[model samples]
Target chain A: MQRKLISGIIGILIALLIGALIMLVQGYNPIQTYAALFNFSLFGFYPLATTLRNSVPLILTGLSASVAFASGPVNLGQPGQLLIGALFATVGGLYLDLPAFLLIPVLILLSMLGGALWSGVAAMLRKWFNMDEFITTLMLNMIADFFTYWAISYPFFDRSAYSPMTPQINTNGWLPIWGEFNSNVIVMVLAFFVIYLVFNRLTAGYEWRITGHNSLFARLGGIKIDKNYVTVMLVTGALAGLAGGLVVMAGPHRFLKGLGANYAWDGVMIAVVANNGLIGTLLYGLFFSALQTGSLGMELITAVPREFIQVLQAVTVLVIVAGRGYLDILIDKTIARQKARERAT
Target chain B: MNIITGLINGMISGATPILLAALGGTFTFYAGVFNIAMEGMMLTGAFFAVLGSYYFDSWLMGIVCAIIGSLMMALIFILFAVTLKTDEFVTGIALNLFALGATTYMMRQIFNVKGAFSNPGIVPIPRIHIPLLAKIPILGNILSGQNLIIYITVLVVILSAFIIFKTRFGLRLRAAGYNAPSLDSSGVSSAKIRIWSLIICGVLCGLAGAFLSLGYVTLFSENMSAGRGWISLAAVILVNGNPWGIALISLLFGFTDGLGLLLQQYMPSQFTSMVPYVATLIALYFYSIQARKRKA
Candidate 1:
């Protein structure tokens, strides 16, 4: 636990340094960018509120990647599942008329189902045909994008409007916002605790951990590896789908083209940076949320362009990939030296 | 007659990019590294190609710029994957995201354009006339004529196959992928071989990107390769990284993409555009099932 925390801290420090270098290249002092980002998120009420609100969908997507990754299937199709889920959620919200109490849960359920069905294709391929889930999921993302684009362009399209977007949902389905923060934050928090319990405190999580660590060993011990693999993907997909519902019901209350906002990719990055474990994802979510919220202020204050944040984000990813191995080597060498000294003593 | 002509010309144009990218993927796969960065590299190549053409007013300069840019990205991939031993998949995702942001940034920075960079000054590669073959019917139109890159692609395919099957380096590449520890025991540096493989892969992917921008559209659009890198990855996996098989599978993918374009002309544009993706699902489903059966 101590080691993981230290490594995480080190990773953030390295990311900050690289970010500073990129800022320097863009003709802005790194100090100002950091100050703006820190001040806004810490003291500014609006920025803090926005960061919390933005984290809602990210939490779900992070969980989506985490669940499958824990079970050993790299669910790269979250982007597609989220898109389809949002589409279904929009249909449920726009077409159906019901009280808020009944409408919200029903739409959420439908969205989860839509996401599951989308992911189910890749899961089934992995189980029945031994096809690589990675390729299938990646390809399905494209298919889903096409489906969503077509939906907004023709059927769901508001003809009078130039942009490709569906009509707003019935007000009854709209989630209540707390001041500036959307009710989506509540949904995200609830999902996090539920997943935390299910993954950390349950026997299912143990099975998943063992299966991921050594599939053959778990199989020999009489575990149903295939079933577990498929089940996790379904759950993960469902959570991602629920995120779609959150978008429609809690925030936007409408389905727009490109509504997923590349969150699927963002979710994967969060999960990876988090190392697919509990607590780590939440922390990474907060970190990314800060970067995103802070970028707005950075853009407002400097002629440096807000995209310097993206350059920072990209550099963080690059450095993380490059630094992880070296970190591991560093730890190994330190351990080796300690052992040698102990032997000499 | 137009359908026949479309069939031939479409296949060549479609196949050219996939062939170049997949062949690059095969080299990396042979060295035990799944270079997922090909997508990003292709995007980088496309951007540089456009940037070069825009500035120099020459397609030749554009192609050169693309290859160099892609090679630079490949070097970064090697630093992480081969030198540092970081996970390939993670690096790939980073590269894809980085490519999107970097190219978009450059596009906006250089030309102040968003989403696409199109200028009248950019030169697109022109079709090369092959003596008697240019007058021939469907065969001539399809096989004998294309941009210079198309002919180059065919040559590259043949050479790649020859190199993989007949060369000592190919044997070492295979050895490293299949059994790295064994190569280590034999006093061979697995890292060096993998690095070389990635460089070669980089050059191939670079050419593929050039073909997309310089060979086909002449303009580089954001995310233009649009998951073709993944398609090529699928081709590599489905064909098991065999160069000849890579060529054949790429043509198969190219044909589907071509057929989709033709089908769209007569059908609803939405469904027509969906043809290639839907085809991928069906083909991948069979591929997976076959692999499972083999494992059982």
Candidate 2:
């Protein structure tokens, strides 16, 4: 835990350093830019509140990736799964005329089902053909992307709106807002606790951990590896679906083209950065959300593109993944040099 | 008669990028890295190819710039995945994210444009225009007036196949993946081969990117590669990294993409655009089933 924390700090430092250099190249004051970014988020309640609202999906998708990764399926299907959720949830909210209370829950459930349906393809492929879930999920993501793009442009095309988006859901289906924060926060928090319990308390969690560590051993120890694999995939997909559902309910209330662009990949990054730990994901998801919104503020103040923040985010992940090994070599070299100097003396 | 000609011609044009990328990835696959950075590298190549061509007024310069641009990205991939020994998948994802952002950012900075750009100053690749072949019937469409990159792609695949099967370096590359420890004991450095494989992979992917922007369309667009790199990787996975297999699979993928374009007039544009992606999934099903049969 200490090492992970230290590595994360180092990763952040390096990520910031890279961002600073880019800022310098672009002739912006890096320190001032970063300061503005923090001030926009921490000093103002609204930015953080809006960030919290935007972060609900990131948190859910991170949890989704964590669940599947814990069970050893790479499950890069979050992007596709989220879109499936959005598409189905949009369909349900638009076509189904239930009371507000019932419709909201039902649309959310439909979204989860949509995610599961898509990820189920990968799970089945893995089970039947021993196909790698990674490739299968990736292929499914493309299919989902094209399929959704087609849907939004065609049948769901909102003639009422000026863009290629579905017609907004009836106001009854909107997630309740609390001040600047959307009511998605309530479900997001509820989800965190539920996932925390599942990770810490459930026997299924133990099975998933074992299956991830060693499939042969897991099988030998009476763990139902195949079933566990599929279940975890479904769980993860459901989490992603929840994210999609919440995204639509949170704002816009429509399935617009490129609604969650780069959002799915952000979740994957968070899960990996957090090492798939529930607490880690929660904290990192919050921090990531803050950074995401902060960068937008920074862009407004410093005239740096938000894309620069993306560059920083990517660098952060790379450094976090590579930091341990690189740091070990650095420490080892230092120790060796000290010992050699003492011997020579 | 025209349909056959159209399909065949479409297949070549469609498959060109995928085949190039798959062939590039095949080298890295033999060297034991999943090399998921192809998508980013190809995108980088595509962007730089256009920039270079637009500035230098030469298609060849565009291809050169692409190779160099992708090589830089590949080096970054190797620095993390090979030298620092980071998780390959994580590094790949990072590379892709960086590529997407960097290209878009640079596009805005350099071209002062967003989304896509094309200028008359940029020269597209010249077609072969084989006069004798043009006189032939339906087959003429397939044989005549193809871009130089298509012929180069065919040659690269053949050469890659030869290098993988007939060369000592190929044997070492395979050993790097299959039995690295043994290869290490035998005085061959798997790391060197892996690095070179990535460099080669980057070059191939660069050509693929160049083909996309310069050969196929003389414009640079944000995310212009449009997941073709991933599609190429899919082809690579389906064929188990065999050059010939990847080539054939890519051709099929290209054909579907082409057919989708043709089918758009008949069907909804949305559904037509989705046809290739769905085709890839179905083709993967058959490929996986074939592998299952072989295993059984």
Candidate 3:
């Protein structure tokens, strides 16, 4: 465990070094750019708040990806699920004339259902047709993107709005705010807490781990692997859907084209970087969010483009994956040496 | 007649890039590598193709540069997924992300433009005019005057069919997918074969990218490869990486894509744009059912 953590940190340092090299090549001072990035992202009040806000969807999506990955299937359908969830939330917010207390919960539930239903199609396809979820989910993402665009542009078109977006959702459906921060942070926190408990304490978590490690073994152990597959997909889909709902409710308060953005993919990256650990996902999500938020500041201060942050994120993921293997070999050799010394003594 | 001819032309052009990428993907798929980085490879190729053409004013140089760029991406994938034993899917996703960022950053840095780059200096791949074929019939109208890459794609499809079925390397490639340990015991390095397959995949994807930028559009735009890589992947999966199957599926998808383009006149483009993906899902569904029946 210590070795793994050390390797992860080392990987991050190497990634940052690569970022520095790129900046240097571009004729910018890496030190100043990085300094401005951290200062604008975390050290200040407004910047920290913005980072936290940006992290909300990431946290939910990260947890979603974590749950899916920790089970058997690779759910690349997060973006599609998120979009469907947001569309459901938008539709509910616009049409449902309920009080804030009732309406918010309804929207959330609706969003989760929408997400579940979207992923459920992929899950069913896998179960009944023996289709690979990876391709189906990816195809679903494209379909969902265009489907939502058609939905908003045609049926839900707001005549008064200039862009392709649904009308602003009812104010009652909006997430409550505390100062600069929205209540969506609470949702993110609650999600992390629940996922942590599920993975560490629940029997279902053990079954999921077993299923992911080896489904044939899981079946032999009397675990319902097929049921677990569907359940896991639904749960992950709901988490991603909740993220979409939170994005709509917390800000914008309406369905917009390209609303899913890169949040779902970023979430998936965080899950991989964190090795699908709940706590690790949270930390990595926050770190990535900070980098994303800070990139703008870095750009303004140093004339460096914000897209460099994406390169940094990708490099970090690659280094962590590659570094872990080398780290394991080193750890194994050290263990062998210690055993030899103990035997001599 | 004019509309039909235009749609047929669109289908051939649309299918060419997808067929090229899928043909490349077939190598990696047969080598048992779940390489989903084709998108990144193609995108990187597209950018470099434009960059090389813009600088050298030669389409040949552009193709060479594209292959180099794409090979670099493949090298990264092999280093992590093959050599380091990291999860192939994770490495692929990261590479895609890296390609997007790197290409976008380079476009800004080198071209001083955002979103897209195009120039008169950037030479497009020339179209081949077969005058005799053009005078023959409707077939001539559909096939003649196409870009050089279109003809190259046809030759590749045929050559790939031959290589995958008749060659010793093809046997080893399939063996690597079926049973790597058995192949290793036979003194054939499965890892080496896998690496070679990926390298080949990279080269083909590079060609596909070059065709997209230089032949299809004559420019490099952000995400210009779009989801063609993913679509190519789907084609590979649906057909189980059979070269002929890839050709057929790509043509089917190309038909939908061309139909979508033609339908844009009568419908909202969002719905029209969805035709190919929707068709892919339906085809996959049917293919799965067929496979299951065969298993039974």
Candidate 4:
């Protein structure tokens, strides 16, 4: 907890310093900019809801990314799977004339299946051909994107419209809202707990860890490493797919092409910064959510361009990475010095 | 004749951006860094190129600005990934997100454009056709007429091949990627070599970015580079980190892209655009099988 807090403090300090530099360059008051960023996000009701709304898909995507990373395979296809999931969810909602209670779960389930099936291709390649999942998944992301664009722009395009999106999902299919908060928040909170249980305390988590640390060792110990790989990837894809469903059913009423909104990438960032831990991902998800929320308010209130927020995010990562770099140098130097001392002694 | 010209020109133009970006990725791979941020870097480069050209009214200035901008990014990446030993992939993704958001915000702030920008003064690279080459029928029209960047891309491809295969530095880079500790033991600073390779990569990606904005479109748009970075990465992987092979693979993708455009115009627009992505998958599958066979 202390380490996490210290890291959080360090991240904030670095962000503030960069914000100051940017303000100086752009001729804006740094303090005012920072105040605008926070005031609109935490204090304003609309902004707080928007932040939670933006974080809905991210929570799932972050969990998906963290789980995959924990399994030692980078699932770079979250964007692709999520897109497919959204499409599936939209279609399910549009065509199915079922009760709201029954329809929502079905849409979620089918979307998860769609995402899992899409990701299975990469998993199969890795297992059968020893293909690098990173490369395959990344490539598949574009393919998925192209597929969605084609679907919306051509066949499914609300041809009656100029927008690049499908018709809005049925009102019955829309996820219910509890006042300002979308009901999807319930799903997100529940998933966080589930992720904690599965990752932290479950036997499945131990199996995953064993396989992730060393496939050879896992295989030698009679664990079905290849099967684990396939299963784990499917689970990762399912979470991403669910994220897509959440976005569509809970937030956007229609299936907009590019709804991925780089969420797959954002989720990966959250997971990476969180270091593949469930709790860490949850915290970082909220932090990133806050950043996005604050940036929107900053844009509304001040001339501080949204790009500054991007620069701030980049600066945050850069500072973190550079800090790690110096730490690496220190460790290497220490190791070398220890070797020298051993020889001398 | 017009159709043939479009196909040929499209192949050359499309291949140029990917070839350069893949080469950039190749340099980082040699240095033992994945550099997935190429997409973001290319977008940043393209945005700066347009911004520079818009302000200075000079393509040369745009190209220079892009190179410098992307190189700065490369330097930051090297500082973090090499010195800090932070997860290379994480930093790459962060940089990409930074580029996307920053570029979009800049477009809104600076140009007052939401998604795309086009203006009269934003001149594209003037096309050039060889004198003797113009006499030839199909090949002349297809290959001869292109912007200045296409020629540079072809030249750089050959140059990169030569550098990778013939130079001692190339050998050291390859050695570093294969086994960094081994190179460290040999008194070669693996970090320095990696940093140099990344710098070279930055230059190539910058050129690629300039090609997209100044050479092809004459305008900058939000996320205009699209997934070209990932496609280039696919090209690099498909070629197995070989410079010559990478260029060839990029050309193959160029042809697929051309085919897609052609189909989009002539065939049903919907299914035609899917060709390039589908082709990528098929090519990747083939490449992976070949790789597996070789390993076996």
Please report the candidate that would top lDDT against the real structure: 3
Q: Write the per-residue lDDT of candidate 1 for residues A1-345, one digit (tens) a residue.
A: 676677777777888997787668757688977988877675678888888877767778888998788778888899889988888999888889999899887888889998999999889878876778888898888888888888888887877778889889888888887788787788788888988898888988778878888899999998898888988889899888888878778767888876898677877887877778768788777777788777778767765555555556666766765676678898899999999999999
Predicted candidate 2 versus true structure: per-residue lDDT over B168-252, tens digit per residue: 9999999999999999999999999899999999999999999999998999998887778888888888878999899889888
Better of 3 and 4 by lDDT: 3
Model 1, C-alpha of A16: deviation from truth (Å): 2.7
Ranking by lDDT: 3, 2, 1, 4
lDDT of 1 by residue, B59-122 (tens): 9998899999899889888887777877888888887877877887778777777788787899
State which candidate, 1 or 2, has the greater TM-score: 1
Worst 10 residues of 4 chain A by lDDT: A319-328
**All candidates' TM-scores?**
0.96, 0.95, 0.96, 0.93
Better of 2 and 3 by DockQ: 3
Every model's DockQ: 0.63, 0.69, 0.77, 0.59
Off by over 4 Å in 4: A44-46, A154-160, A321-345, B265-270
- Cα misplacement distance, residue A285 of candidate 4 (Å): 0.5
Clashes of each: 0, 0, 0, 3
Higher-ranked by lDDT: 1 or 3: 3
Better of 1 and 3 by DockQ: 3
Model 3, residue A150: displacement in angstroms? Answer: 1.3
lDDT of 4 by residue, B1-296 (tens): 78777887787788889899999999888778878878888988898888888889888888888888788778778777876677788778888888888888778878987889888877566677889987887777766777988988888988888887789999888988999999999999998999999999889999999999998788888888878898888888787689889877888888888888877767665466666667777787787788778888
